[model samples]
Target: MTNAPSSLTSAEPVTLSEDEAAQLAEELKQQLRQGQRLAGDTQAIERMVAGLGDKRGLLRLTFAESLGTVGSAAVPALCQAMCDHDNVTVRRAAAKTLTLISDKQALPHLLKALLNDDDPVVQGSAVGAMAVIGADAVDGLLNIIVDPNNTPMQTGLASWGLAFVGARAPQALRDAAKSENALIRTAAIAALGDQIQNQGDEEARQLLLGALKDPDEEVRSEATTLMGKLNDSGWAMPLLIPNLQDSSPLVRKNAALALMKLDDPSAIPELESCMSSEQDASLIPIFRLAINQLGQER
Candidate 1:
C-alpha cells in the first residue's frame, strides 16, 4: 500500500503554514539550482502563487523570487491570481513577482490590475511591473495618462511609469511630444526631462525649447519646471529668461525658480529687470528672491 502524495502535487490550491512555506521555498530553490524546471507544472505553479499569501514577509519574497525564476510560464497563473484572487496579499505579491519576471506579455493583465484593483498597493505593484517591462509598456501607460475617464490616481501612476521608461526609451517620448492632446504633450514633456538629465539628449533639449512657447499654459509650465530642474543654466538660462514675461503667472514664477537653479551671475540683470516690471504681487517675492540669489552666486 502506497501513501497518497501531498496536496502540493494536486491541482487544487493549498494553504501552507509559515514553517511549511519556508521549507517549500527552500526545496524549490534547491530544485531550481539543480536544473529542474517548473515551466509546464501547473500544479506547482498554482501552489507557489498561493504561497504568495504567506504571513511571513521573507517567505512571501522567497515565493515571489521562485516564481520569477519560472519566467513566462508563470505569467498566466500569476496574472489570474493578481486579478481575481480573494486575498489582497496574494494579489499584491503576484504583481510584484511579475515585476521580477518583467515580461511584456504581462502588460495587459498588469494594466487591468493597475486600473481596477481596489487595493492601492496592488495597483502600485502592477504599475511598478509595467515600468520594469520598459519600452513595450510605454503606449499603454501614456494612454492611461491621457484617458479622461481614469481617476487622477491612475493617471499619476501612469505618469510615473512614463518617467521610469523615458531615459531608456526616449524616442517614444519624442513622438508623444507632438500629440494633438495637450495632456499627452504635457506628460511627454515632463518625462523627457528625465531623458535630458540622464542622457543629455540634444533632441530632447530642443523639444523642451519648443515646449517653452507652447500654446497650452500647462505645457509651458511643465517645460519651465523641467528647465529649473535640469541644473544646466548655460542652455536653460537663455530659454527661461523670455518666459518671465509669459502670459501665465505660473510659467513666470517657474521661470524665476529655474533661473535660480542655473546659479549664474549673468542672470542677475535679467532677474532684476523682470522684478522691476513684474505686476503680480504673488510673483514679486519670487522675482526678488531669484535676483538676490543670483547676485549672491556672483
Candidate 2:
C-alpha cells in the first residue's frame, strides 16, 4: 500500500471524523465476522468504497478485507477502486482484498493491477491473489518466472506463487523447464515437485526425467527428489542410481535419500558403493539407512 505522506501530496485526502471512521471500520469488521454484506444499502457500500483510501493504513485494510469478505457482490466496486490514481493505497488495498475473496471474475482486474501497479507491495499481493485463483493464473505467473529479463528476486516470488498454484501449474511449469536459463529451469523443477508430486502425469514425469540429466546440479538434485517421490519402478533405480556417483556431494546425498523413499532393492548395491566412498559423517547414516530399508523390503 502506498505510504505517501498526506501533507506532502497535492491530492485531496479522505475526510472522515475520527469517531465516524472508527464506527465504520468496526461495522465492516463486524459484518465480515457475521458473514453478512454491508446491509445491501447503496449508501453503505459507497461509504465503504470511500474508506478504501483512508490515510490510516489499518482502516484501509479493515475496509478492504470486509469488502472482500462480502465476496462477488463487492468485486466490481473493488475493481473500480483499484484504478484510483490519486490514492495508490486504495488501489493496493483493493488488489489485496481481491485475493482474500478468491473470485476468478476478478482475474482481469488483478492482472491489470499486477502489470500496472507501480508499488512493489501491490504487485506482490496481486501475484499472491492470482495464485489463489488457480489454473487461470498459471499462464500469467509463468510469464513472470520464465522471463529472463526479470530479476532473481522477482522470479523468486513468481516461483513461490506457482508453487501455491500446485497441480494446476504443470503445463506452465513444463514450458518453464525448457527455459535456456538454468535458474528458471531449477526453480521450475523445484516448483513442479511441490505442485505435481506423484499425481501420475506422464508428461510431467518425462519432463522431470529430462531435468534429472540437467547440467545444473540443483536441477538434478531436485529431479532426483521428485523421482523418489514418484515411486515408479520403471525409474526408481535407473534415475537415482547414477546420482549416487555424482560429483556433487549434495546430489549424492539426495539420491540416496530418494532411493530410500523409493525402497528399490536394486539400489542397494549402489547405496553400498555410495556408503563406501562417502566421507561426510552425516551422509553415511542416510546411506546406511537406505541400504537397510532396501534390504529389509527384499
Candidate 3:
C-alpha cells in the first residue's frame, strides 16, 4: 500500500504520484456514476468520507458530490466534514453536498452553518438547503424571519422561504402581513396569494381584500391582481372599481383586468370613464381591452 501524507493532520504538503492521482481520479468517476447505490455499502461510505480529507481540491470536491448523491445514508459523515474538517473549503463543500442530498436530518448541521459559518457561500448553501426542505423547514425559517438582527436580505429570504412550507404557511404569513415593515408585509401577501389559490378560503380572500387598501402601492397592486384572479363573484365590481381611480397606474391596470374577469355590467360605466380619462399611453390598451370584454358580455 502506498503511504499518502495526511491531508487533515500532517503539517507536510501532500504530494501525489501520477499513478496515485490517476487512481483517485478514477475512483471519483466510478463513485459519481454509482450514485446513490453507494449508500448501501458501509465500507464504501467510509472510504468516501475519508476521501473528503484528500489534499487534491478536485478529488475532495468530486468525492463530496458523489457522497451527496449517496443521499441520507451519507449525511452523518457529511455533517462531520462540515463540523470537523480542517479545511474551510472542504467544510463548505460538505454543506453544499448536503443541499444536493436534501436530507432533513442534515438540518441541524446546516442551521449551524447558517449561523456560525464565516463563509457567505456556506451560509447561503445552508439557507438554500433549508428552503429545499420546504414545509419541514418552517421552524428554522421562522427564526430567521423574526430575528431583529438579521439583515434585510436574510429576512426577505426567510419570508420567501415560508412560501414553500405548504399548509403550515398561511397563519404565519397572515401575521407577517400585519407587520409594521412594509417589505415584510408585501412579501407575505404576495406569497399568500399562491398559497390560497383555488382553495376557496374566505379568510384568505378577506386578507387580500384588506390588502387592497395598503399604503404601499406595490402591496395594493399585488392584492388587486390576486383579488381579480380569485373569481369570487362578490368581489367583481365593488372590489375593483375604486382601484380604477387609484394613483398608481399599476393598481388601475390590475383593477381593469380584474373587472374583465368578473364580466359584471356595473363595471361598464366605470370602464368607460377610465377609458376616456386615462392618460397613460400603455394603460389605454388595457382600458380598451377591458371595455371590449365588458361590451362583448352585454
Candidate 4:
C-alpha cells in the first residue's frame, strides 16, 4: 500500500488547492476501494484524519467520506482529532465523518465533543454522529437530557439524537419513557412521536395519548403538538378533544391545531363550545381558524 503523503501529517492546518485536494481524495478512495488494509496503519490513519481540515468544502467532505469507508478502523483517530484538534474545521469534519462510520465505540467521544466542544459545528456534528450510532447512543443521550447542568442547546442536541434513535430503535424509547425524571419522560415521549411519524406505530400513538394527562405540562404540550402532526384523525381527534379544556393554554392551543389538522368537520361544535368558554383571549384566533378551516373542509 502507498504511504499517505507526508503533508497530510502537518500540525498546521492543511491548505490545499481545489485540484490538489480532489486528486488526493480520489487517490485515497481508489486505495480503499481496492481493499487495501488501513487497520494496522495508525500513522496513516492519523494523517488522513488531519487531511479532514483541508480548506475546500467538497474535498473536506470527500476526505471525511473516505475515512468513513475505513469503517471502525478509523474511529479512534477521528475521535481524537474531533476532541483534541486545534483546528475547528478538523474537529467538525472528524465528528461528521464519525456519523458516516456510525460505530458505537465512537459514542463516548462523540458525546464528549457534543457536550464540551466550543464550536457549535463540532457539537452539532458530534450529536449527529451519536444519532447515527442509534440504539447504543440512547442512554447517553437520555442522560444529557436529564442533566440539569447541561445547557438548553446541549440538552436540545441530545433530544434530537434521541428522536433519531427512537425512529430506528423504538424499544429504547419505550424503556426511556419509564424514567423517573420528567425531563427524560418528556424527551422520550417526543421521540416516540417522531417514531410514530415515520412508522405510524400504533403503540407509540397510544403512549403519546397517555402523556396528554402527564403531571408535567411540557409533556402534555409535546404530546398535544405531536397528536396534531400525526394526522390520524379517527384515532387522535377523539382523545384530543378533551385537551381543548386543558389547564395549559399551550396544550389547549395545540389541541386546537391538531383538531384542525384532523379536519373532521364534526369538530365544529366542540371547537365552538371551546371558543365560547375559553378564558385565554389568544386562543380565540386559533379556535376561529380551526373552525373556519374545518368549515371550508365541509
Candidate 5:
C-alpha cells in the first residue's frame, strides 16, 4: 500500500465557543446586508449553515432567513439542509429560503415536502416555492394534485401552483380530473381551466373540456367558469357541451356565461333556453349582462 504524505497530517477539530457563534452570526448578518455579492459571501454562508444544526431552532431559523435572501451563496448550504436536517422549524425555514433561491435542483425536495410533510405551513411554503421556481416544476406539480392524501391546504396550494405553471402542465391536470378525491379532482380541473388558461393550446383545451364531464357537480361548475375566461383563448368547440342544462345550478349559469363570451349567436340560444333552467335567478343578471354582447366584438 502507498503511504500518505506526512505533511498531510490530520487536522485537529476546531470548536467554536459561544462568542465564536455570536461573532460568526454578526459577520454573516453584515454580509447579508451587503446584498447581491456572492463572491465574498462564501465564508459567511459556511459559518451560517455550520451553525444551523444548533439545538435552538432559532439559530437554524435565523440562518434560513439570512441564507434565503443571500441567493446563490446560500444555495449549496440550503440544499444540504433541505434533505439532511432533523428540525421541522429549520426545515420550514429551508423551504421558505428555497423559494427565495428558487432553483430547479430544489424541486425534488420541495415536492417531497409538499406531499409528505406533516406541517401544513411547511407544505404551503413548498407549494409557493414551486411557483417561485416557475414553469420548470410543471411535471412534478401536476402529479402532486393527483395524490390521494391531499389535504385542503395541499389542494389549495397545488391549485395555486398549477395556476402558475400554465398550459404546459395540462396532462397532469387532465389526469387529476379522474381522481377519486373530490377536492383533488375539483382543484385539478379548476387549475386547468382557470389557471393554465390553455384556451389556445388545442390539446390542453380539449382536455379541459373533457374534464367538464366529470361526475362531480362542483368540478363541472368550476370547469364552466374556465370556459368563460377562454373567450379570447380560441379553443376548439366539442361535439358535446357540458354544463348545458346540467343538474347543478352553478354549472348551468356558468355555462350560459361561457356561451355569452363566445360571441356566437348559437350560444344565445342556450342562454335563452337557460332562462328557466338557471336555478339561481340571481345569475339571471349574468344572462342579461351577457346577451347583447353575444355577437359584438370583445
Candidate 6:
C-alpha cells in the first residue's frame, strides 16, 4: 500500500528548524529523567528503545547507546537493543556498554554474543568485554570449546579470549588442554600461562601442571615457558622437574629454559639427559641452548 506524503518513513529527510530540534532535545532530557524515576511515564528513552527496530540503522544505534548511558533504570529497555537491535556491530557495542551502566545481570546477554554473533569483530568485542565481566563468563566461554557441537573454531576463539582473562577461567583452561586439536591445545596452554600469570593461585598451578603434561609437543613447550611465570615460587620445582623429562624434544628444550629462570640446579640432570638424548636431533639449536643454560645453572 503506497502511503501518502503525510506518512513519515524513517529515512525521510529530517527538516526540523534548529530551535525546534533544540527544544525537542531539552524536552527529551526532562522526559528521560521522569521515565527513569516514575516507570509510569513512557519517556523519550522508552520511545527510543522501542524505536530501535525502526528501519533507520544509524538513528537506532545512536539511540540505543544514548539510552544505555542513562543508568540503571534504562537497562530493561536497552537490553532489548542487545539482540532486537538490527546492526550487528551496534548490537554488540550496546551490549558491551550496558554492562557498565547497570545490569551486572547483562552477563548472560554478553555470553550469547560470544557464540551467536555472526560477525567476528562483534564476537571479539564481546570477548574483550567479557574479560571485564570476569569469572561468571567462564562457563559459557568454556562450553564453546568443550562442546564439539559448538564448532571448533568458535570454541577455540572463546578459549583463547578466556585465557587472556587469566586464572578466572581455570575450568576452561583445564578442559581446553584435553582437546585433540593441536591448535586448540596450543591456544589453551598459552592461555593457561596467561590466565595464571594474571590470577594464578594454587588451582592455577594444578591446571598448568596438566598443560605441562599434554601429549602435544607445542602444548608441552608452552607449558614449560609458563612454568617460569607461575606466581608461587613453590610452583617452580613441581612443574619444571617433571617437564624436564617430557617426551617431545621441544618440551624438554623449553623446560630447560624455564629451569634457568628459576636457577634451580635440580633440573641439571634432566637437562643434561635431554642434551645427550637429542644429540642435535629434532630440537637442534633449542637443545644446545638448553645445554648451555644448564651449564650456567651448574
**Per-prediction TM-score to the true structure, in the order listed:** 0.89, 0.62, 0.55, 0.87, 0.57, 0.57
lDDT of 3 by residue, 1-298 (tens): 1121222222222334545555765776885676524443665665666666567778777777777667788887667666556667667777777878878887777766666666777677767777777656766766666667666666666666666553455666677677787756666677675656755556766777789999999889878877777666574578778899899999999999988887776688888898789888899999889888888888
Clashing pairs in 4: none
Give me the candidate number with maximum TM-score. Answer: 1
The sequence of per-residue lDDT tens digits that candidate 4 reaches over residues 166-225 is: 677788898777677788888999888667877877787677867989988888988888
Best by lDDT: 1
Residue 143, model 2: lDDT of: 68
lDDT at 48 for candidate 4?
Answer: 72
| Candidate 6 per-residue C-alpha lDDT over 1-298 given as tens digits, one digit per residue, 9 for 90 to 100 | 1111221123322233444444544555565556643232336555545444444554545445556556666654445455445556446655655655644465566556656667776666666656656666665565566566665657767766677666655676566666777656666667766555555455655756777777667777877887776644465766676766666667776776777776665656676665676644656566566557657757
Which of candidates 1 and 2 is the stronger one according to lDDT?
A: 1
* TM-score attained by model 1: 0.89
Q: Tell me the tens digit of each residue's lDDT in model 1 across 63-153.
A: 8888988888889888888887778999999999999999998888888888788898998899999998888898888889878888889
Regions of model 4 farther than 4 Å from truth: 1-23, 33-40, 197-202
- What is the C-alpha lDDT profile of model 2 across 1-298, one tens digit per residue? 1121122123433445667878899987887778775664545655676787678878988877767656777776666666444577777787788888888877666666665567777778877888988878766666676666666666677778877786766777777788887866776777776544556666776778888888989888888887787657565678778888887777888999888888668878878987998878778988998888889999
lDDT of 6 at 252: 70
lDDT of 5 by residue, 1-298 (tens): 1111121113221234556766766665676677534332656665666565455555556566677666666765555554445566556666777887778877776776776667777787888788777667765665666655666677668778877655545566566666777656677666665444434455556656766777778877777777766655345223224466688777776776677666666556655666646667777887766666775643
Order the numbered candidates by lDDT, best leading: 1, 4, 2, 3, 5, 6
Ranking by TM-score: 1, 4, 2, 6, 5, 3
Each candidate's lDDT (Cα)?
0.85, 0.74, 0.70, 0.82, 0.63, 0.59
Positional deviation of residue 216's Cα in model 6 after best superposition, in angstroms: 9.0
User: After superposition, which runs of candidate 2 have C-alpha atoms over 4 Å from their true positions?
Assistant: 1-18, 25-62, 69-95, 101-126, 135-156, 194-199, 231-238, 261-269, 278-298
